[model samples]
Target: LLLSVPDSTTGTISVTGLNGASNPSFLGMFTTIAGFEPAGANFNNHYPMQDNVSDFHLYDIGEFFPIQPVADYNAETGIILPPNPNLSGQLKEYQIEFDGFEQVHVDVFGLVTSQNGPNIRTA
Candidate 1:
């Protein structure tokens, strides 16, 4: 889930996934990094502050910069993607960096074995 609030200083400009979720696990995946892309023609630079996890990975203007803005809540894996300046026509979507995985349940004791896979959900 994406949560956004208008900039206190710039009311017209709202940021998505800025404040971040208080409970990192609330959305199932811990929001290691979150950023916003403004609506416009040119590609602008935005900041994705480190929230629950440190070592936040960031991509800006064809370069990658990793920083630690928050206390350590280390992520097991890092999310990656090729750089896109257009960002799929800037609708103010939150660039969410998350490790997408789910738990599996198995009935080891029963003769009839049952297996379960991860649940899939859309934003």
Candidate 2:
């Protein structure tokens, strides 16, 4: 199952496996890491505030940035790409850095087993 946040433009995606029956299990996750491109693209140069939920976790724009400690959250993983979600669905204005211009196409592969049965309307 895929959940998208159309309102807000930026956020992380959490992939949980659900069996046909409970809570979902963690599969994989991924977050944006700034400063991977141009020299001026360092996260510290543009956004100084550190948000764990933000895709970019580290930036060295000529500053002593205390990198966000990597965790088992939805923003960190080698095999997961997070979906966008926002709390306020009305005002959705978000801008982020991506390798691709405008949009980025992602591919995910995993066998999700849900604990909730099909009777439950997750949609």
Instruction: Identify the leading candidate in terms of TM-score.
Output: 2
Error of 1 at 2 (Å): 16
**C-alpha RMSD in Å of predicted model 1 compared with the true structure:** 20.6
lDDT of 1 by residue, 72-103 (tens): 22356554444454333211123343222121
lDDT per model, in order?
0.26, 0.29
List residue ranges in candidate 2 displaced over 4 A.
1-89, 100-120
Clashes of each: 0, 13
- Can you tell me which runs of candidate 1 are displaced by over 4 Å? 1-53, 61-91, 100-123
Which candidate tops lDDT? Answer: 2
What's every prediction's RMSD, in angstroms? 20.6, 19.8
